[model samples]
Target: MSHVTSPTGLRYHLTHTPPHLTAHSHATLTLTVHNPTPHSIPLPGLTLALPDTPTGTATPHTPGPLTLQPPQGWTTHADSPTHHTLTPPATRDSQPHELPPAGHLTFTLTNYPTSEPGTSTLHLTETPHPGQKGTDNAEPLPLTLTTWPSGTIVNPPTLNKNRYNNGDTATIEWEYSPADGIDYTLTYYPQPAGSGNEKNTVTYAQIQDHSGTAMSNGLRHAVYNTTVPLTTDPVPFILTATYQNDTRTYTTIASVGEPDAQFGKLQVTGHTTLLSTTPQTLTANGSFTSPTEGFLVCWTAPGTAPNKLTVNTNGESRTLSYSICSGSLTLPLAAQSAVSYTADGVSGDQYSVTWIPLGHAINQ
Candidate 1:
């Protein structure tokens, strides 16, 4: 029979189909024991013996124990004293009989035989027959049993993080390969830095779009985050992913204990003051150059500004005013350039013209 070896070790499959067997008759299955490992092994022949005296004592000597080389799980159990009697027939209460100067003999396994899939161990000890000096018996040997390996086996997943900006949006993805019989659950925890007295918590969620790729075997997905704004402090994070119904296994794919990737700056910059000017009236409010998407622009005014005037807002404005009152004001260069002359001759309320550049010039 052929078999596939697992990288985790300790398993051998019997590939061939079983043959039809007659009732009460033994069936011998032909199988090829192949060791997935690259190394080879050598095993010893089994031997069994009995003691002549009721009390047995064998001279101290190391009889070679059974050896099972790679790709082999076959052991021999001869009908010798050690193999046959673990507990002597209680009725007789009689210990086995043996001869002095007893030497070792080899026995090949028959009856319950075959190189089947299983685990095995052997015990090689010495004992001297009671009242019989120099006469010793072999110690009892061990038994072996074979079975299939089962339960979920999981390999660690790799996480990939891309560059993102402050206030911008980015996603974290993970990939994992699971065994044929296993299922998994992945949880993601994103904690921003400086979540203390200086900063507020940012609420985020793990989004699972119907048309998205999953970290595990497409079994499940989810999102989590706070409602406050995210910060730049070293925020700790954790992810707990598990195989379905696996209460006996655990592994860390990523953790707060290890080095983590930081979030992007999410920079935002635009006019913050509302323009109650004379022309090109507009209203706009939203994130500025967010990482996930771009900015948004909206305008609403009773009548368009007199000239091609620029519009700006502080995100929330519901009223507009245009009354000439002596006061200090701030304006963008684009707005100032669109205007002609202001009453330059005025005392008590003097004019202070400020210039702001709206276009970038390449270096020479």
Candidate 2:
């Protein structure tokens, strides 16, 4: 319900009969105009204004012109799809009609579509008759129109990849066809597998249809990209879509896997130096090594902790058993000795290693 008074001492009351309307449905608005002046006034016309159609691929059905039922002896003059003008008989006695002081008129607007779900301000204005001039008789009254949800989700959530290594990028996509007047919301959550707690949730509101036109094939789509960090367990993801008074949700899983081959390479610099107070000796066990360069390999499986290998040289060949642990081995190099070694007993696909000079630092 809404009320507005014009300068001409006329009060207008607006109301939507049913109050709540659904998208793609019909609605009726009733307007009552009251005259409060002491003298009879000539009736002019009325106008109703609606908001522009939503900007996108799907266009709303255009509404037809407005219809007006004037009081007895009054005739409709100007009529347009959204505007109408009514006037009393031009000459008194010639089917003359006028609103006596304190009189009122009631009219209804029917068959309007509530397809788009949202707030629409209907501007109802009273037009002035010829020779009538004043601030009070010409203001437009604002009435709020609200519509509810009448649509559903057409496309569910989908992920580009189900498996990701630490620091890998992944994309999620979904789509929804909106009701005539409703907007949609999308939310995503990434939680650790088997954990009831949610790590984080991302939300997107008023999501627009990427497809410029209505997707005749199915629901329109939207996409989101994210990076997966290293984790011990698989991550469960959830996507939720909401529109008006309705909500839909979906879920999927992503697993963390071992590092790739590129991540397995040992990172170290050459020309590194080693120092020792006493004659230090380094031994290369089942680990693989290069004579002119230092090398070490370390890696962890999807479910296991990470470990590495280290070798020291006394500038001579020495056999040592390798184990998965963190430690430093120092060895003195013999003059002009070509040191070489190999991992003759080590085996596994989950191992990542790095090799550096006996005294050099290792970068993983």
Candidate 3:
């Protein structure tokens, strides 16, 4: 038995000639290879290898080197039992023919056994023309063969909507039979437009019993909450669900057009008209009126401790203390009253008081 490997290149396709072949039956193996690079390359030779099964040994009958004519201009030669070579035909100019870029080559193995129900492999080795160098001398291209399956597999989850608006909740629903020891993981990738970065958020859940049956009509569901910050452009939400060796992906879009209107109403508030010189005395019990809702009293004082503000309202005096930093203090006024605010050692300080009416708290 041989270990089968996958093919590496822009695109490669391998299939059994008769779609389905029973064990010990003979079938043709076809391979199509696409050239992805810009420069023309020397085509590679392919070697087919099959697995040894209890029934019989899966063998490939090798064919002679292939010669292709103009418009194709390529020639293939079997260098050995397990090696083949592809090169441009010799020309009057004596130049080596090369496979055109983006072109494709199809090769077939006439009769190969299915021998066993498992995997078959095809190994491709490049036999360079006279003086070709670099990647042309790279490793062999390995491709695994796909066998017809015995039964049908369940399809991946499907979404009801492909697009959503900002703050929209998306639901992903899927149905599958429960298997012991099998768990599922769902991951969401939020890619903001023009951000050039993908953010991964993952959620894990165990497949639960639906109506006490391994397979049921009721499907499991998950929700993607998009209440947080979103991008300005359409955000792509990619969700991938995985269970053991099988995995599936679903994608949805969240379009965030013009900015949220509520975000624009946020701003700093206060009066800038009052300016006082340092050490200037405020008339004792002087009164300042604020908006009906309230206002934020902000001031800058020297970075020193014991900054004091005394507020006298209705003959009751209270002193508010401030620490070493300069910041703001909220003054909520419910009703009109003769309120006096006096600052000690904060005279001539640059201060601005912004009004914030009731019900205007940004977070609310």
Per-residue lDDT tens digits of candidate 3, residues 74-97? Answer: 555555644555554565766654
User: Whole-model lDDT, candidate 2?
Assistant: 0.54
- Clash count list over all predictions: 40, 27, 6
- Candidate 1: lDDT of 43? 17
Decide which is better by TM-score, 1 or 2: 2
The residue-by-residue lDDT of candidate 1 on 219-315, one tens digit each, is 3333333333223322323333322222222333222232234558855598443322223212121112111111212222223222122223232
Candidate 3, overall lDDT? 0.46
| Residue 137's lDDT in candidate 2 | 50
lDDT of 2 by residue, 1-364 (tens): 6677766667777776466566677778787888888898655455656544532325554566545556566666544454556555566565334568999887677776665665555676666555565534566667655555554544667778767765565676776664553344443334345655435555454345233245665556677665335353465556665544334556767676755335466567875454322221234333333443333433333333444443333345554434444333333334444444333333344334344444543323
- Alpha carbon lDDT of each predicted model: 0.28, 0.54, 0.46
Best by lDDT: 2
Segments in model 2 whose C-alpha atoms lie over 4 Å from true places: 37-39, 48-61, 65-67, 77-79, 91-97, 129-139, 151-364
- What C-alpha RMSD separates each model from the true structure? 21.5, 17.3, 16.7
